[model samples]
Target: MNWYVVYTKPKWEKKVAEKLTQIGIECYCPLITQVKQWSDRKKKVEMPLFNSYVFIQIEDADRNSVFEVAGIVRYLFWLGKPAVVRDEEINVIKNSLKASNIADISVSQIQVGDKIKLETGAFSNQNAIVQEVSKTHYILVLESLGCVLKIKYK
Candidate 1:
């Protein structure tokens, strides 16, 4: 069996993985626990490590069954063939992510004109570019729609 990457619909990684597993498909969707603060309280939540992507181990004959699952867009194809991920590489990703704390993984210094994916809030999963940076916030520009958003970090 070979490991393959499947592209899923927005925010559908978990669901697709679950459904695929129910039908006897071996799928892995790595998730990370995040502590989020709200106005009244704080909660810990699990979110997909790689948004819109799931890994599956299967034989070539089983490829068609995978695409039948809802929310699965298609297999990630590279160079006219389904992209195959090595087992060792997948193991490294899983092990590294499991050993690190959320804080250590989340903090990164982004610069102007750097593109980033919004992981939380109303702009979740949207891609934006850094326009300006302040002490506790970033002024981001959404290029596709020509709008600017001010996002504050806690």
Candidate 2:
């Protein structure tokens, strides 16, 4: 079985993962704990590490079974096919979260128009082209993932 990326409804990642698991599908929704502050109080909440995305391990022939659950929009596609995520890539995410020190990781200097491979974060191990860079953020085009990523720095 290969791991496939599933696009979920906004804010439905956790719920979708839960429903998938209940139906005997193996799913993973990476979550991170963040402190949220409101006018009245501050609280630590666990949020999905990847917004509107969940990873599921299933046979290719059984791919359509996922739609039985609600809140699933569609499978993320790349190059006219469902995007496949390597098991090692998934393991990297799991291990990194277990360590909980990923925030301390840093990247070296990069310039606009440079092709770089990310070593950490959600897009780790993927190649990206530097589209734009500024003092506040970096805009990267991830061809493999079919999306642009904006990374903010202080």
Candidate 3:
């Protein structure tokens, strides 16, 4: 068995995992509860560490089990094929998710035309290109969106 990455519909990682598990397929959805505070209140809510993505451990002999799960948009790919999830990368993400208060953050200092790299927190090792800057965030361009988006900072 090997770990495979799957792209899921927006906010559907948990749902997909639940369905997959009910059918007897092993699924892993790493999550953390964030303490979000408003002017006078605080509450904890669970959120997926990786947006729109989930990981599954599938045996090469049972790959079909993956296709049966709902909300699975597709597998991460390169050159029109499924991509393999590196053991090391999965280890890092798993270790990071185990820790709490994962620094709710969004890069806003970076402008639409500026370049930025994660300086701290969960995203520290990844690089995302900025497309637009909002009062509270930096809009990142997704390969599919062909543009940018705003993400709020902690």
Candidate 2, residue 130: lDDT: 89
> Could you give me the TM-score of model 1 versus the true structure?
0.63
Candidate 1 on 22-124: residue-level lDDT in tens?
9999999988788999999999999987788899999998798997799999888867888887675566457645553322223258878899986744454
TM-score each candidate: 0.63, 0.76, 0.58
- Model 2 clash pairs are none
Q: Which run of 10 residues does model 2 get worst, by summed lDDT?
A: 99-108
Best by lDDT: 2
Residue 95's lDDT in candidate 2: 73
* Model 2: per-residue Cα lDDT over 22-101, one tens digit each: 99999999998889999999999999978999999999999999999999999999778999987876785687568733
Which regions in candidate 1 have their CA more than 4 angstroms from the true location? 100-154
- The order by descending lDDT is 2, 1, 3
Judge candidate 3 against the unseen true structure and give its global Cα lDDT, from 0 to 1: 0.68
Q: Which parts of model 2 have CA positions greater than 4 angstroms off? A: 103-106, 117-143, 147-154
Higher-lDDT candidate of 1 and 2: 2
Q: After superposition, which runs of candidate 3 have C-alpha atoms over 4 Å from their true positions?
A: 37-41, 100-154
